[model samples]
Target: MEIKNNRLTGATFVEANAYNKTAVMKPDAIIIHYTAGASGNATVKLFAAKTSKTSAHFVVSEDGTITQMVDLNRKAYHAGTSSYNGRSSYNNFSIGIEISNPGYLQKIDGKYYTWWEVKKDKKTATPEDKVYVGKHRNAVTTMTYWYKYTDEQIKAVKELCQAICKAYDIKEILGHEEIAPGRKCDPGPAFPLDALRADIVSNTKKDLNVSELFKDAVKESASTSLTIGRVKVKLNFRQSPSSNAPLKSSPMAADTYVYIIGSDSTGEWYNILYEMTGWMDKEFVEQDNTDDNYDGELTTNSAMLYNDQKKSRRLVSDLKAGTKFNILDQQENMFRIQAVVEGWASSKYITKI
Candidate 1:
């Protein structure tokens, strides 16, 4: 955790996008950023790309590996359109540290997923301690989770900050949120901003409690079985109770049997078995004590399979009287059918068996 030759030798130095090209100025502040991507390796490469308009002095991975992108004397184009303490441009007076994080989690239906659509499963998933309401960088406060920044990451950041301050005489350390406020929410609530600063100022090191930071969720309770409901539309089953979670490679079709624990707080996504228990939207899917499995028989000879509801949709295939197809979802007069003839069929032409 030391700086030599004007660079953090512990960090891999690679020049990336250029900004603030004037005579290198001694940076007095540090601006923290989140890569908002899945992995640190991928994010660092993007910064190295000439077309990428962003670059940071250093990047910290989820595993705590550090990569230096630009020299401390040189400015990194990270804090865009940002100002702090009478300073109009931050890059000119600050060294930027990009933290590797799957920035935000978006819940679509009931499942939790990352912005990159990576599924958040219990094995690797960390339940958010408390849901944040109100505007996030102007995003309507949908239920969001605090990413579990690892202890390794925490120590690394502390060490890096200590090293940077010792070498450059930096006066204050701050997050991107403090600088941009409503326009950004990086190094978010999940980050212990106040404590981090305190540790640096007082030089008293303390480790943040992971349990106090992340929600401890037991496995979905027993005595309840959740299966994907029958629906006319295709449903996205995710690894977590968020639509933002990585989608189960295949859409959950109607009548697809799914196991459930319970609905998320929103009472939308129902957990099921996929990559060892994820979430599926409750609307187009469902969870019930009894599995809704049945057979439907066509009553008419000229019945046609459609991509959507019967009358107004284009035909998907043709079917004959006395034909049997497994039911996926059922509407009043149209049914989504699976098997050899997989699509929507007129309910009048089919009878439940």
Candidate 2:
């Protein structure tokens, strides 16, 4: 297939030297797993070893750093005996991402004891114990083995998954357990599959033809007044709506104004503005105010008296200002007013004075 986007960076690959070939397959799904190892480096070494015969496309560290062990085009040696949606050979068409974690269960008080240690019971055979030795029930020491994934790890996974989805036409993303079921459960219940899938779906929808949506928004925003404290703020321009793009120069000053050009939403980054337009913080621009005045008052006619036939008419201009007007009559749409200048000005400017 054509390389529309390349998001697989920071990944390391190992060719099947013995087979004298690499498993090149178009991935249809994303399989998530746990390393069952203490660290990402350990997982990497395990995959690198020729005898291990196990590897994944990516290995995410506890802090969420990603180490690629295989190329996306080539199949990684993960998902052994896995099936998804009634299909088999998952390793051939799935991208495997392994998170560094200790295996499902561990034994504490064992030779390899760490802060997060698992305890295992040592069996000793004696005369009395010999009877139960065949069915020995060793008293195991219990240590606190916490299964905590750091925030950084979660963030890294989210970014990586989004990038992958953008690069390939990958529609389905699943955990190893979900695909393999009875065979494996690396990415266990602790992983937020539902939340992750929801995010992926939302992002995919957003990425579809976002430029067009932005263009439409810009066209619709022409009539709207984008003001900051009565003066229009300058737009911080960008080549794309994404924040990752280099910042473009400000196009207008606080007093100058422009129309909205376009917008796109990428995860947390909302790209608004195009080359024809410019980027503006969503917080800065106020939507169009169609009303004539901010205070919501009505302009007046020649008379300034209360027209009992009609209703009330609000004084549009401040009465204390240089142009003063007397209330003759009030109407729904028309305002009757008699105006006089501050000093003895000319009556030419005033009507019904």
Question: What is the alpha-carbon lDDT of model 2 when measured against the actual structure?
Answer: 0.50
Best by lDDT: 1
- Worst ten in a row by lDDT for model 2: 130-139
lDDT tens per residue, model 2, 1-353: 11232336544444422221444587767888877677988777777777877777788888777776666777777887754333566787888888887633322232222223323333421122111111000101212122455677778887787777767767467777555442354465456665776677666566721233233333444454222121246645556655566666655455433344334564332233332444556545543323211111222322222212333322111121222334344444443443210112122334332
Per-candidate TM-score against the hidden true structure: 0.52, 0.46
- Candidate 1's clash total is 19
| Candidate 2 residue spans exceeding 4 A from truth | 1-7, 10-20, 103-146, 208-353
* Model 1 lDDT tens row, 77-191: 8987664433456877889998898665543344445644544342333254423322232122222354557777878898888788768757557788756542456876566
Off by over 4 Å in 1: 118-143, 204-353
Model 2 residue 267 CA deviation (Å) reads 44
